[model samples]
Target: MINRTKLCSTVVAVSALLAATTNLDAQKAFNSSDHYLAQPLIKNIYTADPSAHVFKGKIYIYPSHDVEAGVKENDNGDHFDMRDYHILSMSSIPGKVTDHGVALSVKDISWAGRQLWAPDAAYKNGTYYLYFPVKDKQDVFKIGVATSKSPTGPFKAQPKPIEGSFSIDPAVFTDTDGNSYMYFGGIWGGQLQRWSNGKYDENGSKTDLGKADEPALTAKVAKMSKNMLEFDGPVRDVQIVDKEGKPLLTKDHNRRFFEGGWMHKYKGKYYFSYSTGDTHLLAYAIGDNPFGPFTYEGIFMNPVEGWTTHHSIVEFKGKWYIFYHDTQLSGKTHLRNIKVAELKHNADGTISMVETYKK
Candidate 1:
């Protein structure tokens, strides 16, 4: 009794209408901008030590986690003992977050069978490299490298640690000359070295680069072997000390210098950003070369609302931005959350930090 041809046509029209409505809903969701700057992007209930890198138009964050309810706990009573790194990737635009859960886990690799912390990732050519610090049961901390063909990856580590150095907080920088270097170290001191093939050789060492009274900041350039891990340059020191000298102190600790070395190039000059004092406020210096004969610029941002900050900076979509962590959320473990701000360079050559917007 019913006309089959008419029924089929009516079904096709209804399907097309539904498809159009669904597309419009998606477009609206993607186009709407919400203020995410003050909100945690991922509400895992525990995320810290966030490191962000933009690869192929996507923003990837590798953060350290302590424990999650559903996850099994190690003997230390932590869900994961900062021994594993997790990757979360999202669109650079607001309202677009795509989490590839637990992209890389230390348990997946035998070499770094213990702990992973402070992960930094960079992409070159068709390969993505993740640099992070690991620890074995012996409590010896070392830096390690993993490579994947994609940003969201099952990263594979080398047979052993990369430089064979007792180092932590590894930061990778590829300079204007196409040379790559790794700057690391914290509570002890920080070092800058050339990275080649798969190794790091000390081009220069800073026993006390951030000592408040030091006259100048110094750095020496070195070459590594084809393996890209050995050093071939001299150990040089550049002067970086303030003549007047301001003593940095915290409630429970005496302040020295050194921590979180992040560098960027703008308008033909290089800026090296770091943190200092017991409060861990953000500070910076400028040098003519990546290796420096540098001068301390001064503090860019101090603790706001009694929260200490760490150093992390990046340039996104032609705009310069600084990404640092604050203790406002969780106090005990430095349950650091990432905050961004626009960076402004003053006419007098000083820089200012501005709070970031999510929209």
Candidate 2:
């Protein structure tokens, strides 16, 4: 009963409408430049465990490089070696990073010898201090300190290792009272170490602030002696047990939910972040004090659909944004790409993970 001409017109109109709707959806998905905003902060260089510190308004990213591969040669060809720390700096831009040249190189340090991994840079007074771990020919690892007047530096390593302990992943935190502390540990009995005056105790122990269900330890604000390396108060033992009171250490393997420990204080509370699992997914806990009776805060970000995630957190910049690494494009090479995304905290303080880029 419908006219042939009218039926044909109706079919054409519906097709045109569908085409217009598809075009509009595509425009909404692809119009924003945010999808194209990612630029390599560091180049073809495979870097990992990136930590950023803002000094004099410039951001310095100190990462462990595959320096060994850069220097070694095999029968077929030369392989990239990860034997040194590579420091890169950039000016502050909301969504961009400008590659400042190599701020520090291990080959330039006299005592490094070989195998410098996971360097952390921090500025105090008029000097920039880089805390990094290095291994000798025997493969024994130790943490050391290097000082420079500038962040991008020809850094000079201390004549010897700090306290002669086999440690790596050194992170330095300075309290409001001018006291400095260093936290470093991995599978090999990870423990927090403190420094005061000019002398450091290799046997400096950590305080065991139990989990949230337990009583919190009294927060201490101690002063450093003239030596700048020794602590004045009793160092407490840090508990590495989970909520069920079980040890976090894995007997068969080394690393047990313990690597890349970072602490930040915000609004009078301190947050401790670390990496866990064989895949190194980012996990965190919160405490009222730096030496914490911390409670698990849950996973900030897990491995994506196509990539593995690790060593990351949200930085407060007007709003909170998470920074992490992804390996979707680069295979198992550890040549990971850094990503940033806004983080939304729930009423109960839980965080929601969102896509790093707009697309």
Candidate 3:
């Protein structure tokens, strides 16, 4: 939680920014060679936390629809009080993006509270599954699933959130063998710090344990059942360690998992990339297994103009592109615009660093 004064200031600041930017023209077209300065893919309304995927030979993005809700800011993410979702799709990068409006809303979800956060999509057995994290009636964030026959959809959210789910940022990865797993967690206002004991503790530390020397909080992972509506097993911690197999300490903020879990496979290695929230870097680790003791690699994306950097990576037309957000659209931390950049993987299975805000 935050002081009332700080909260009011944040809300007023964001509202002022929206007023100034709502009438501005859209950004320039994307440049693959220099995507650090790439233009936003959507401009009519604010969006952040892009979860890009390719389905049926087209690019689709599932992101939180950013709106000026006038809610005050706090460590519990009160200021980011988004109410609904919109689906974005394009046949190609640097092309026209179509906003398939109002996929799902709080009013339509029976058990949902407010603030629907970042979402991801998966296609399985002729059905498209939309996975998202939203606060329940009790104000606890729970990951939920929605379904649609079309990749772009007005999805029908399930009646309840997944039984064993907790926290936010749901990234689903289906491996080569047809098995699926979800990686999720976020700290600070995201309420991830409250789940350190494998269960919710309302009085838990808002940030972390304040133990800089101790291992940092781990992200959670679990396999999805065949129905894709439930967890097949117990949710487990995802260990991120150094080359020598030491857990990243709480003080090592630059390279630890914070939020925005994106799992992609390259040449037989499981690449688990995530946001280092407070430090604002996009980092990745690799392991031989999906349920990883992943070895820490290095930072891939530097900070954008905003305080939060959430992203997704997908291969489109045999070329890899990363979808992420920055504050350039509104010059406000709460309001953001999504952008895309082409990614390159080295011969040794290493990724090239992406400097988002370059001179």
Q: Please give the CA lDDT of all the candidate structures.
A: 0.53, 0.51, 0.84
Question: Candidate 2 regions off by >4 Å?
Answer: 1-39, 67-81, 93-95, 188-237, 240-256, 304-316, 354-359
Q: After superposition, how far is residue 160 of candidate 1 from its true place, in Å?
A: 1.1
For model 1, the stretches where C-alpha displacement exceeds 4 angstroms are 1-37, 68-80, 93-95, 188-239, 243-256, 304-308, 354-359
Q: Highest lDDT: which candidate?
A: 3
lDDT of 1 at 184: 57
Model 3 agreement with the true structure over 1-359: per-residue lDDT tens digits: 33555644654465346433432311221223243468778789999999998898899999988888787766677878888888999998889999999888888888898789999999999999999899999888998999999988889999999999999999999999999999998987778889887789888877763566679997999999988889999999999999999999976777877889889998899999999876667999999999999999998887676668899989888899999998666866688899998899998899998866445
Model 1 per-residue lDDT tens digits across residues 1-359:
54545644554465356435533443443343342334445555456556677777767776665443344522122333554566777665344555666656777656664656666776666777877777644444566777888787778876666644444566566666766556554432223222221334444332332222332222223332233443335423333333244323211121233445566777778776665533435677777776764566777765422123454666667765566554334433234455445577887777885433332
> Mind sharing the TM-score for model 1?
0.67
> TM-score for model 2?
0.66
The RMSD (Cα, Å) of candidate 1 is 19.5
For model 2, what is the alpha-carbon lDDT of residue 201? 41
TM-score, candidate 3, is 0.90
Each model's number of backbone clashes?
Answer: 19, 32, 1
TM-score of each: 0.67, 0.66, 0.90
Per-residue lDDT of model 2, residues 233-322, tens digit only: 544334444566544532211123445666665555666666542333566666666566666666665433122233534344455555
List the pairs of residues colliding in candidate 3.
75-189
